[model samples]
Target: MSNVINIWCIVRENRSVFSVTIGTNNNIFDLKVSIKDRRSNYFAKFDADDLTLWRVNIASSVLRNKDTAIEPYLNDKLEEPADTIGDTFHNVEGSNVRVVVEVPVTTASVENLANLFSQMNVSGSSASENASASPFTFFTELVKIAPNHVQKLYQDIIFEKITNPEYFLRNDKIQLGNFAPNGTASVYLRDNPTPTDTEDNVQNLFNDLMLSLPNFGKKLIVKDTHNNPYLDRLKPDLSVFLEEDVRDGTCIPMFVQTLLEVKKKKSESGLADEDKGQLIDYMNVLIQHQQLREHFALFLSDGFRFYVMVYERNNRQYKEFITNFITGLRLFYILLRYDSSYTKMADPRSIRFYKSPGTYTNIYLKEFLGLGTSSRVYKVDYNNTQAALKYTQSGNAHHEAQILRFLNENNVANIPNYITHDGHSIIISPVCKRIRNQFRAHHALQLLRLLSRIHSKRVFHRDVRPSNILLDINNDSVVLVDWGAAIRDPPNEQVLYEGTISFASPDILNNNLESHRPTATDDLHSFVRTMYILHNPSKMPIIPDGNLATKARVIREYWDDSVDVKLAGPLWEEMVNAAKNGDYGILEKCCSIFKS
Candidate 1:
């Protein structure tokens, strides 16, 4: 059981204080739900982990970095007793418990609120009172948000280290500074290299860039214990690994997080498809042994141009991001802005062009399974076992892991077991063969049973359509997959209508589902249409474009009782009526009809 605290938060919104009860365990997603329920429109969309009650309260001036203020009541519980939170607000019985929910970013509105809330701006406030402002709040308000500015600042600092390592060691607390605190910095450069020495220059430049990685207390910087036997494998030109066990007082050689392959500017032409393939192969080897590492960035650079492929081990997906040396230099610094987890995986890789019609060309190391809006599924042959991998191109919004984890926790059946999720990609149970035969009445019953099991656990497969419902031919079982569109059984307002328009419900197609909270009825509607299509493949009509109102009327007409006229047998007719009315009990009643 986790500890939780219920606190009345009086947030200043539109010159009025709106009071809401929030618990410690409630995340930003839950907060959004509460906001919608209260009909408050103060905050815009933000990441789930970004806005937390503990973080916001800690950054508040009233708290003054005091543990006694809120920490006494704070615990890791989903729901805690009222006594644990204490009866009074911060030891004051009648005091107003106020907390300003700052965005913590450089938004114009955030800055205005920061200035307004700053004790320094308040008249008659002493310096001692104003000093109560936490350093975290001040830093959040004043921190620069522009990427280019940050990169240039870091680039200059790293270049200074390259010019005079001793000066950098004495003056700054940058990358090598923390690890080698009392020691002098040794520049990894070949002495007195001439203008003709392109390889040496490239190596030196790469070394500087690697050392520029901000060392935030962890022993991320390590010397090249060159000539090591491990180098025999892959034999990258430059290999940088993060020491994960240093915090335990032991500097153990961990995963190789970054690998670089350098070629002379004159030999740039030598970089072909084979070089790229070799880099990917090296990454595959790293991924197998060093699965702990989030990203294994393989860079092939020819002093100027760079071709990089970052293998995200958790996601089990990789993407290529091409850039020149000049942009690459800035990119390295920008990469540090992300948590080691995200940066350790790879820089952003967008496949916008690949999303367009007829734009997909099979360029894969493993067998391509299928592609969705957010991920491309592939079948991989791994150590004599087969598994499916879903790779989401950078910046595409998807939360398949969250959905799968929920379903898994509830012990939902018929779906694939979640193997691993690496923020970007996911690997699941072995891919089953596609259903070659048209779905029959028996298949519809199996699907209904699967959906009933899923719904029993309070999960709605919002995208219940033919393409998403997979078939496990071995047991003739149906597996409903692509949990990307899955939502809690009751559904949340945030769960938007994301299914195919043709198969979408009349309410969804008409945009009439208030607050966008999808219901089991939506799934049933799609299922009814899916069964109709499977039963009458040749007779099914096409869904046209134009007016959505007209589209809704057409959808309603198609799903009416008369639509069952096209269904072949009595089992389908019963199933059709059940699905149209969102009655799942009929599935159990008709189970015997198909079992025979």
Candidate 2:
């Protein structure tokens, strides 16, 4: 029965929204009263009952940000008097705001119109006289402002605790002495300054200001991040941290007090997502990495203009503050006093390249050694140590890492040595080579033995293709790789198709409906199919015409053809026929298949 749980109500004709809290049983009219109460200044002449309300129903994905006009998107009207607040808005996919009430202009009364027009040029005396009594005149005046000024009026609202509630902003004139009372500051002017000049010049100007403002409150240390990279080569222009928090070069997210990004002009907001989006990237470092702190101040500036925004560690709630350059520095001073006295994170044994839910390879830009439909394998050289790094932009990295760690813990043989993993990359030692037609009968036997050991642990390497079978001839290693598709003792259910179709088990790939559960038998069956095909690719299993009934015929003919030439022992024939004909005896004898 919850209603408007921390949802914002976007009033009409305003650039922003104010948060609304309503009772579960509250109807559409109650929502209107709530909006009018908060915006009483704008709704002075209009009674709460007179205000019209609507229900904004839009997908969360399209909730535009930062003063986006909401008129066109507002199509749903709250005409139902019986519709409770909860029933009005669906919390579908974490909606951002309830853009409900829009302000309606109250037509000025005859006396109020006289008062307003009198001020229009009639006289200052008549304006001062009627202004106090004429609320309609005030509403009329607000209506005359441009849309951008309305944006300014709404941008002033922010979440409590992020800023002082008494803090107010307007397009009021600012005095130069507010920033530099002594004389014209160097930051105000530059020698032939261009768009690029703003970034460095502002950094230098801040450094100069810090030098003269020592102990004005507390000592603050600022580091220029122009050259220092963070979170894998991504860095903000400036970061403030204690000297001790500065490790080898990494900026611990929990310790960074404040961040600033400088842009030359605000119009750069049009050139890509440079303006606000750049601030978000810096915040992402903290929000995605750490869990300790609740909030931090990220300041954005365009030389003379300043902006403030607060995003929690989870980034669910957002608030922005706008001010002139000197006032923005005041906000920076507020950041300096932030209770960064939180506990630090302890060091861990294994390094975390990135956290789970992070499945992109944006951190790496090196050339890859191998590519596949869903993954890329890179040859990385880190501190004289070489390893093959596998990148899959999905949970597959975690899945494969889990299986490799399990098998590695059991001292399983022939699998690549497990190195640490983070992000979408899993590093394994001894880069192995792929085979086209080089697979041997003895190699097939060795792989069967490998799968035997894997199956003994009740783990199924469902994908037994040649590409996943790695060979390091000089090192005498026959390894198995790419365990992402492996299912670990899954229940007997319809097995959806996984792994390369060419090398996958016919039990999985051949069925018209492909309805079968995962089992150790499937791996053994897949291994037999792969071995027959790997020895001679010209003769391979084919689902001719994709007919379910004819699939067994083609498989039988393919396996019989391989067996006719004595490709290997009776194992390939028995294994394929056993799977093709639903023979389960071969599943029990897989350990000794090649041994026979």
Candidate 3:
């Protein structure tokens, strides 16, 4: 499970005394392993496990209290062995089993030992036994001195001596002794079928991509790092910041402008709530601490579900810009290879949108949804009637694309019908406003029923205000618009509140940010507030200024008076009781308020 190994070694530089005791599988050796001086000579290679196996044969004999010199059997002697064994002791007293073996060492051997020991901090300068030091220090040191032929063997010796041999193995390679089918000591590359392998491979993939940024004509400094400031409160999986470089001929400086929070999942389960929250937290942090005015991107993936969001600093809102049900790796490739920019739809012209029966011509974005913004609400002629189309230059068309398809499949009520998307834009059937200014009690019930249907699917329209509520006078139909703030039931706490301050529930306005757990009750509260604003439009009061204290005072005063309104009778009574008790059954309680 853990990878680290320790070997006990002692070297007497001046006295030419070399002794090492390597333990593996309770096999300890007190034998002299000879070293010969050679500038160019080949030696056998052995990994730590192999060296341990080789030493097992000589372990029992050398375990005697007497000194034993293990002679070096070389194919051809390049030089003479330095010195024979002078003294050795096998003092197996306590757990601190002290053993010494005199190894024959030449001048070259002494040089290597000195170089290795100096690096290991175990040079013969100290008088006491070199205790508590790891054998890995020696192996790593020998890697510099040992030639290619014998480097692995020396490393193996170090591994055989250490406690966690696996930890000492190279990260690119994995020890397969435990996993070996034949019970033989074996090692393989790290591309195995394991969660750690998948996670590691994903990181390695990004690291490789980071190294290849120069190919993309981008001259920004890029790095793949972990555990950095993301909103200064949370640490995300990957944090990449891109900044423009300002060079003064002498000094080069970088101004960070773009921060991305990247999450990876092993499977295609889609982005989890926590992962979404991480990205939201990162965006919020940048806005709060850095006074972020420029747009930055946030990315999330579960290897299965992929999403990209752009934080619009002007409005302090995050808009879903892109998403895909495809593999995250493929989505990452698309992000890197494909450039992200808004398609100019402002220059309107006649175009045909391909639908089921035939192509719908005369499709054009008729009105600007937000002046100076890259979004528009278009009126299109289709199916011998008119439909409304909302198009955006930069937003997730694919997310709504999938949702509308699902709604059409199930024949859900009180929502727009899915038309088509042209990679960057989306079209849907629009719900026109009623001719009359006021919505009757039955209209309220229809809207409530729509809210219930949406909630049943675990979705919440976080922004439930008047402008977003649309009406069709012919059928007395209700259509909720502006799903940019829509989210699943378990809301990501990192996402800052994007709803209207005046209509926000008391708990939502003063809820604990640390535990950003948003339930259906928050939406229900906003729904109740919407009804009051709609019915008593004249009596409503605007909280002066955007100050937090003033907004809090306004929300408190409004809810206390409106929820106890006696003129509305049992309908208002049911709504008041629901709000007072924090109950989420608002639609059920007010069912008596509606009748055919």
* Winning candidate number (lDDT): 2
What would you estimate as the lDDT of candidate 2? 0.53
Candidate 1 similarity to native, TM-score: 0.36
Which sections of candidate 2 miss by over 4 Å? Answer: 1-198, 211-220, 252-255, 265-273, 313-315, 340-406, 409-453, 460-596
- Clash totals, every prediction: 8, 3, 14
Looking at model 3, residue 110 earns an lDDT score of 21
Q: How good is model 3 by TM-score?
A: 0.35
- State in Å the error of residue 203, model 1: 49
Which runs of model 3 end up more than 4 angstroms from their true locations? 1-362, 366-374, 382-385, 422-424, 434-438, 489-495, 512-515, 539-574, 579-596
Taken over the whole model, the C-alpha lDDT of each candidate is 0.46, 0.53, 0.41
lDDT of 3 at 480: 66
Residue range 1-596, candidate 3, lDDT tens digits: 22222323222121222234323222222122322111012212322211211111123333342332222111111122222122122323222213222322211222233233222121110111221111101010111112222223222221112223232123325331222333211121133221234555655554554453323234443444444422233444554332322222111101233333444564445554444444544454343322213454556653334565455545544455334423323333333332322100113433445443464444643222211023445455555556666555555566656766765676777776777775445667753652124466666776677776777777766656555566765677776655544565455555444334445566655641112355566667667766655543323344444445555565566556443232234565567568546555564554333333
Q: Write the per-residue lDDT of candidate 2 for residues 1-596, one digit (tens) a residue.
A: 45345557665555446676777678777777777787888776566766666566543334445333344344356666667777776562344566556554322222223333222211001112211110001110112222223233333334434354123221122222243454334343333233445566766765555444324244446777856765334567777765655655556544566777766664644222335555544554554333235655577776566777566445456566666666776546543543332112221112235644554233322223444444556555544677777766553576778888999999988887778677466888776665433455556666766777887788887656655676766665577777766767677666454443444454554452244676766776666655544533332333444334354455544434343343234655566666555444463444342323
Give the runs in model 1 whose Cα sits over 4 Å from its true position: 1-364, 382-384, 394-398, 438-442, 489-495, 510-515, 539-576, 588-596
Q: Which 10 consecutive residues of model 1 have the lowest summed lDDT? A: 132-141
The TM-scores, one per candidate, come to 0.36, 0.35, 0.35
lDDT of 2 at 421: 79
What TM-score number comes out for model 2?
Answer: 0.35
